[model samples]
Target chain A: MARILVTDDSTFIRRRTCTILNRTGHEIIEATNGNHCLEIMQQDKPDLLFLDLVMPGLDGFGVLKTLQDAGNTIPVIVLTADIQDAVRDECMQLGAHTFLNKPPAEAAVLAALTDALAEGERKA
Target chain B: MTSAAHSSSTRQLNVLQKDAITELMNIGVGHAASTLHTLIGHKIELVVPEVSLITLDDYHQLQPYEADELLSTIWMGFRGGFEGNTSLIFPTDSANTLITALTGEMDDSPELDELRAGTLAEVGNILLNGVMGSIANMLNAALSYTVPEYMECSLLNIFRKNHTGNDTIMLARTTFAINELKVEGNILLFFKVASFEQLLISIDRELAI
Candidate 1:
């Protein structure tokens, strides 16, 4: 099972997402915001990251850019309430492996996790 | 600007502009409903039947809910190309009913205590994000939003706290039906004079394109 980091400012969303991932036997790590996410990444280095945009500070874009600049190839999946095409394009360009809307369905979440893990393995 | 001037400006929108705004709101509400259905595993129907722009002074005349009716409101402030506050407002009873239906909470309390308030806030966050995101996408406007806040208050009190006479409001009457439960609410967008003008410019740009 892969160890994953889920970052979002909303406690409810974090709990919901972690519950879903936990059910699948993946180890779950939580971060409250983007800055916290980066701090965790430096030490924990999870197998996958579920990032949320529109956070309070150093949002998803900032995290993605930081990882890209550091040459980190960890597979990143962006989950956000923002549905703008431009936002999706920016996420992908910043190296997000997958983009999913907020309140994502369980099946879609699982599918994205599987694909992201496989892609990560290939890169490794 | 004076209240009268603001009212005049709001009334200056041509029929086509008003229709376009209403249509955009309809699309946003539709998207929000789809997201809610996916989240709750329920059949959900959400529609924006009408949208009106009026100055805050006109608020009392156009008030949909009784002035003293208690409401569960989820409010989020947004800024970028334009600045405003948007809210999802439901009668307190309807809000409680919705939470109970979604969570299977057996609590019959009419008041949304802290725990339930969080749940409602998240739901509101998702719905408001859906509407705001869709509109922003269509307008090609980038916006930053404050985290959603949940409050229980009367409709008049809410207006008193958040608005001034110089502001303009775009009020959308929204209907929500989940399974057999039917709940009606209002999606209110409050903007200052400058922001309202900025919004009109953006809308005009969208129309021109």
Candidate 2:
């Protein structure tokens, strides 16, 4: 089980994602927006992050750009309703590992978690 | 600018520009329907969205219902790659039906209790965010949204509260359905004349029209 951070301004989405991850025996930390997301990462690094793109403060794109500039390699799985191809491509270019639509399928979340955590282990 | 001038300017949009705007609104509505389905674990079917562009005065003329009809509204302001005020307006009855469907609680009064109001705001957040996000993605612009606020007021008051000069309203009416239950609501996005001009320029560049 990996330690994961979930960031989203929507309480429902955050709680739902946390519930799904908890079922997999993973430790979950939640943040409401991009600024909070960065704050959490600085204090304690998680194995993976589930980030939402549209947020009140700094959005997911801002977070990704900041991480890339800081040379942080944390694998971020973007969770968002914005599924446009352009968005997907941009996130990937910004170093996102995978993209999942909001209210993600449990199986897909687990699969992504496995892939991201495995990558983290390999790098460590 | 005067309301008359604003109305004429909005009416001057060529067929192509109008069609493009409608297509963008449809994409946004599609995103909202999918998100709603995910949240409720219910299959949601969104009827084809109808987009209307009108001045606030024109909007007033279009309201045929009683002036005092109460509405459940979730309002938010957005800025960044695009700037606008967005509100999800549901008739009292429709709002009650939706809250009941989501929470399994029935309330006769149209006014949302605190718990129900919170749920409604969250729902509005997801729906509006999806809509605005789709538009932003197409424009390749980043957007920042204000926290959504829930209010119960008459339809006339709702408009009065959001009134501003040099505003063009884009109203998208769509029917949301989960089996037998149907909720029809309007996702109203109000853009300042200047901001809307920026939107048009961005669209032209993005679509290379």
Assess each prediction's global lDDT (C-alpha) against the native: 0.78, 0.75
Worst 10 residues of 1 chain B by lDDT: B1-10
Q: For model 1, how does the per-residue alpha-carbon lDDT over A1-124 read when each residue is reduced to its tens digit? A: 7889999887668877887899989899999889999999999989899999867788888999999999988999998887877778889999999999888778889999999999988988
Q: For candidate 2, what is the DockQ?
A: 0.28
Cα miss at A87, model 2 (Å)? 4.5
lDDT of 1 at B60: 66
lDDT of 1 by residue, B81-198 (tens): 7788788888886788777766677676755365588778878888988888888898988877887889987777766665675555655445677646665566766665577678
lDDT of 1 at B129: 84
How many backbone overlaps does candidate 1 show? 0
* Global lDDT of model 2: 0.75
- For residue A14, what is the lDDT in candidate 2? 73
lDDT of 2 by residue, B2-117 (tens): 21223444445555665677678788878887888766777876666555555546545434345677788898888876677788888877777787776676864555476678
